[model samples]
Each structure stands twice: as structure tokens, then as C-alpha cells.
Target: MSKHVDLPDLIPVFPLPGALLLPRARMPLHIFEPRYLAMIDDALGTKERLIGMIQPNEVPGKKAGGVHRIGCVGRITQFSETEDGRYMITLTGLSRYRARDEVEGFTPYRRFNVNWDGFDGDMGPTERDTGFDRPKFLDLLGRFFSARELNTDWDTLKEADDELLINSLSMLLDFEPEDKQALLEAPSLSTRRETLVTLIEFALRSDGSGDMMQ
Candidate 1:
């Protein structure tokens, strides 16, 4: 899908640690907190139903540097209200943005003025990693999973396309917040793939006992 011409400059942001939403990928989120529930309600009233997913950077003393500079904007594509008033929502990523400024408002949730520069390709089309080495990657992945005693549908993973396989693994893996942030900020699919491999290799080398997931 092409970029939305009406994509707003200001957007509500959800500060979640280790949560990532890459373009062309979908993330399922549960809205339970009162502040976030209000954020959802206000987002649903917008034309695009858009929200920004960002990671919080807690500095030792600087409270101003809380939110990360980069984030992915996603549109709420699926939503359902539970019996207790919580919301189950799926966000389909639209683009990666740089949070230029924090917009102070009376609303409960935080908002940001974002810049979509350098990420035009995010909204253009799904990307494929031409240099992806599937067999080798799977071999490493198998070892990693086995070390952690993690079970997955190997057949299904084999059938998934390059983008889906890489991005899904990047999202689902129990990597540290900084590691996941690196994956999110990677410029391209191939770069992200390389980053994923390096992360896994590091995990393997650091501890064969599979304590990497911890």
C-alpha cells in the first residue's frame, strides 16, 4: 500500500519496552490501562486510527530523554472489546518515524510530532531479502531454539517468505530490548537479517546452556 497522504504529523504514542512494529508486519496489543484505553478510544475516532509504538529509554537521571527517537506508526486494523472493557487490537505497521518533539497535551497518553523522512520505502511495498540464506539461517535457528528447548512449527517457518520469516523471528524472539531496537532501526530487510543472525550467534557463543533467553 502507498503512503497515506493524510498521515498526521502528530500521533499518540505507546511507550512499550521491547515491543516492535515493523512496516508490513502486524502486532497484536492488549489495551488494559486506563490511559492506554483512552488513547485507543481517541485513536478510533480519528480518520486513520493510527498510533505510534515506541520504546522507553530510561536514563539514569535525565527524565527528558525517556522516549526513543525512532518508532513505527501503525494503523488499527482489528479491534474487539472484551467483557471487562479491555481492548484486543491488532496494529498493521505503516511507517517508521522519528519522534521530532513531544507534544504536550491534556490527554492522558503522550503524543509526538513525528518526521517520516528516510522511511519512504516502508510504505511502498513488502521487501524481500535477495541475499537471504534460508538453509543456513534455519540451521542456526534450530540450534538456538533447541538450546532453549523452544518448539516451533519448522515446516511453517520453512514455507514463510523471507520478509515474514525474518521479521516474525525478530519480533517473537526473546531478545533484550536494545537488541530488538537494533532490529527495528535496521535500514532494510537484508540489514535486519544480518542483525538477527549476529544476535543469535552472539547468544549462542555467550552461553550454550541456553540461558540467553533469560
Candidate 2:
């Protein structure tokens, strides 16, 4: 089965570094900055609150650098206005895109013309642990936490479904920017799971591994 959606040529893009959003995951964004606030207004006015969440290849404040080629488009599904003049919005991932051209304009926030050429649409099938090795992964997390005396909600974690379980674990585990990017850019659930395994193993060998894990 194929899943498809029409993608516009001009789309509002938010280039936020160090923030990674996976498919089927809800990312809550607090729009406080003036530029981003303007972005929200534009999106709302058009009734097309579709924004591509991309990361800067370099630091954010150093005059926005080029963004990663691959990014996901999120739609504003939930929003709220706060008393302090900020917007709390939760974006749900819809599809992935490739940046075709960067739009140069007077807008403070960035915008881009994108190409959805190779987007496969649907969130691929859930990957089952091929080695039946979840036990080892579980053990590593437990020991990794005990060694650091870290406080974690084991009960809640155990109750989560596969997608939530992996995503939550990825966020809680100490992964480098590059490692996190790898997970974000992973095209399939199986690949992301593999990356998580490697990260967990690396954390066990590093000093004060908690710092290196998160």
C-alpha cells in the first residue's frame, strides 16, 4: 500500500538545531521568539500550518547555516495561547521532504521550497528485535541507571508501546549530537533500533556515562 499527500512548492520551514522529531511522535514547541511567532501567524492565516523541522548543520546563532537535506514536515494539530504572549503548539509528523531551494526574504524565520520526490509516506512497519535480544538491552539500561543512581520511571517505561519505548529511551539515553542525528535521519524503524543498541552499549563503557548518554 502507498500513502501519498500533496506537497506545496513553498512551505514554512523552521530550522531548529539539536531538535529531532521522529514519525508518529508529538513534538511540543513553545513559540516565544518574534520570528517564530510570525511564522505561526502566517501558517494560521493560510490554514496550512505545515512546517518542515530541519536542523542547522552549524550552530544556530552564527548566522543560520545550511540545513540538513532531509527533514520531516509537521502539522500543527494542537495549540494553546498562553498568558505570557507565547504559543504552545504540538506538531505531529506527517511526511519527509528534501530541501530544493532556500527562500531568501525579509522574514525572520526561514522558509524553503522543497521537493518530496522520494518520500515513501507511511511510517514503515514496526521492527521486531531479530535477535530476541531485548533482554540484553533492558539489562544495559538498568545497570546504566543503577551505576549513575539515576531516577527513572521503570513502570511507565515498561508500559510504553514499541515506538514510544524506543523514542523515550533515545531521549533519556546520553547520545551525541551526531548520534542523535543518525537516529533522526534513520529511514526505518529497524535502523533506529540498531542505532539505539549501539548508543546504549557505548554509554556503558564511557565515564559518568550518563553525561555521554543524554
Candidate 3:
């Protein structure tokens, strides 16, 4: 979807730390909770068909950032219902939104008043440093994945466009929730790629400074 979606004032949010959706990327979700199932059902019935993916703070008593102030908005592009009554769906990201306020809702799920002004650049690639050290990034990725004793098809990994690569890695890797959110909130695709590579490099360092204490 090349066109930016008209921002919505309120959206049903799925709060799961470590799960992220970037504009134009697709995130598959399995919905079994009664409230979320209802949320999906309502989305499927609506013309907009959107869901917000946000991370909540894991630290006990940190309610302020518990449900992050920002999130990505995605439209349901595919949907299926299981015999077990769960909903399987794929959300194609539209844009990132900031949660401005929580509005009272009649449904079991909660809704948030969101603002998209901050994410105007999400529609497409913006002017970014195109020469941000791809070789070093790939090299660090090699070391990081190798240390974990994992193998990847370097051929495929090399072919994905930078945005896909950055967002995909940011989602697939075991970065802390805040770290992942940092990647999500990166100012530009270029910055996100740099941040991702730096995070990997830090993780590979023997001293393990990448360890952010929860």
C-alpha cells in the first residue's frame, strides 16, 4: 500500500512487547483472547480495518511507559477463523502513531486517541545517508549470528532492500523491548539500520554492554 492511510482518531491496540510493525511491512498475529478476537472481528467489519501494535513496559510499577506512548498502525489485509475459534490475521502496516490519550470504550478491548503527525516520513524513503557502512553491518551480523551457532542463507539476506532488512532484523532479533522500540522510533530508515548494526555489534562484544538490565 503506497498511499498513506488517513490517520484515525481512535484505534484498538494490541500491547505486546517485542512485536513490531513498520509501515509497509507485514506482521502476522494469532488472536485467541476474547477481547482481541472481538477487536479483530470489529476491524474486519470496518472499512479502515486497523490495529495498533505497541509495547508495554516490563518493569513493575513503571506504569507511565507501561503502554508505550507511540505505536504502529496496521490494516488487516488477510483474515481467517479457526475451528478452535481463534483468529489468524496479517496486518500490513500503514503508519506509526503516537498514543495521545486513552478513550473509554464499550468493547472489552481498549482504544487510544492517536496522532500521526510525527510519522509523515513513514510513507516512503526519506533523504537519508545512503552510504551508512553496509559492509560493517553485515560483518557484525555474521559474528553475532555465528556466536549463537545459527546459520542463515546469506544470499537471501543480501538481497532484501535496506528497509526490509532493518525492520525484519529489528523484529526477529532478541533485542530488549526498549531497544526494539528504539529501532521502531528511529528518525529515519538510515538511522534505524545504523542503530540495528550498532546493537548487534554491542551484543557481540565479549563484555556484553548491550545487556540492558530490565
Using lDDT as the measure, what is the rank order of every candidate, best first?
Answer: 1, 3, 2
lDDT, candidate 1, at 197: 91
Candidate 1 on 1-214: residue-level lDDT in tens?
3646457889999999999899889999999999999999999998899999999989887876498899999999999999999999999988999998898879999999999889989988679999988888898898898877899999999999999999999989999999999999999999999999989989887775443322
Backbone clashes in model 2: 5
Q: TM-score-based ranking, best first?
A: 1, 3, 2
lDDT of each: 0.90, 0.73, 0.81
TM-score of each candidate? 0.94, 0.82, 0.88
CA lDDT, candidate 1, residue 134: 88
Clashing pairs in 3: 57-66
Clashing pairs in 2: 173-213, 173-214, 174-213, 174-214, 175-213
- State in Å the error of residue 31, model 1: 0.9
Please list the residue runs of candidate 3 whose C-alpha ends up more than 4 Å from where it truly belongs after superposition: 1-4, 58-65, 125-129, 206-214
lDDT tens string, model 2, 1-214?
1344355777888887667766667788999999999888888776557878887777567765778887878788898989988999988776677887888887888888988776563345544444435555566678777776788888776766667778666644566767777887776666777788777667767745543322
Encode model 3's per-residue lDDT on 155-199: one tens digit a residue.
Answer: 888887777777878888888888899988998888888788778
Better of 2 and 3 by lDDT: 3
